[model samples]
Target: MPGARRLLWLIPLALVVTGGLAAGATFLGADRIESDLTARTRDALVAAELPSATVAFDGRDASIGNVPADQRGRARSVVLGVAGVRTAEVTGQPAEQAPEAGGHVKRDLQVRLDQLLAAEPITFQPDTAELTVQGTRSVSRVADMLTAAPANVTFEVGGHVARVPGGDPEGARTLSEERARVVANKLVEAGIAEDRVRAVGYGDTRPRSESGTTDLDRRVEITVR
Candidate 1:
């Protein structure tokens, strides 16, 4: 009779052990899977020069942010390639509009222009905000481009900087602000009203490079809103 009583006690003890193990397994498995998913995302984005992004999973639905329309297709493609990623909720991609859509002509141009600006940042003297000879030439061309743009459109200058080697923590902000200001001033010289052009510096607060490389992360984007 004592042996049977002991057996009953063992049954509940066994259940408790099994339950604890199942919970631990679940926690570890989820952590491992998400870590792998994030690494894969970083690799693909860095390779493509797309902005850095993050993922959050609640069950099989993964939320992804910081992608542009030009790169959203790629994001979806790569995420779907990962095992167990059921649905990817992607946000922050620029809204794509066709020129033939009429009212969207300005927005369409903005997307293309932002892409161009990201590819090339206006040149400056080493460690200084002063524009180089080449930079002046670039801005001159930009003036003409802005002059030709729809008069009703408002142009915004966006400046981005990275946490760089040999650069002060506040330096990133100062440099970015100056860069944006210089461009905005040039636009005003090109005949655009000061109010029509908004100059805003994002500093190192909004980094775009997944690889953390300063060169690509330091950029200025011109957008129409």
Candidate 2:
């Protein structure tokens, strides 16, 4: 009878130990899974040769922020190949130029601004807006451009957006306009004359990209008039 009682005690003890082992195993498994996913996703981004290799993984949905100039798709495909990555979403602009024409100083400044926009690509985060590292570089170039331009020249910082397909045209326009405003503010902070610069949002009305299906359609254009 005493042995029987001891056996019952051992049964409970064994069950507790087994339960703890199971829990520990589950935790380790989960951790391994997450680590594997993160590693694979990061590797895919590197393989894609994406410019901005910043990745935001939300479960099955993975988003890349900084794509290099000419290899966005290649990078995206690598991510898609990962078993758990359901989608590889790109959330930034490409680093490209749309040609240019201006005198030495003006052309130089314009090129600088273009470089900034291409690298930083204005991102509106909160009540207070700030430029990314790339933005800072580009804005510095614009400031240089303004300094290089005629001291008394007046400039208009206009905003423009690509038209949305089957979406709210007015809303898109407003957003683009606001984006313009933000860019203007950055330019002003970089030392452009306040009176010389003005920001106007065009919102999806004047689109550089007509299709409106691509991220390029949603862009910020700066026209210094």
Best by lDDT: 1
lDDT per residue as tens, model 1, 1-225: 999999999999999999999999999998887777777765555544443455666656677777666667777777776777888878665534213324587777777676655545565564456776766776777777676565467778876665666767677788888888888888776666566799888777776677544554555667786
| Candidate 1 residue-wise lDDT at 153 | 75
| Residue 122 alpha-carbon offset, candidate 1, angstroms | 2.2
Residue 104's lDDT within candidate 1 is 81
1-225 per-residue lDDT for model 2 (tens digits):
999999999999999999999999988886776677878887655444332366766656777766655667776777788898778876788644323434565556666666766665543432223344554465566666664465445566655555444767677666666766777776665555566677776665655454644444444555444
Query: Residue 147's C-alpha lDDT in candidate 2?
Result: 46
TM-score attained by model 2: 0.41
Cα RMSD (angstroms) for every candidate in the order listed:
15.1, 17.1
Each model's lDDT comes to: 0.69, 0.61
Rate residue 220 of model 2 by lDDT: 52
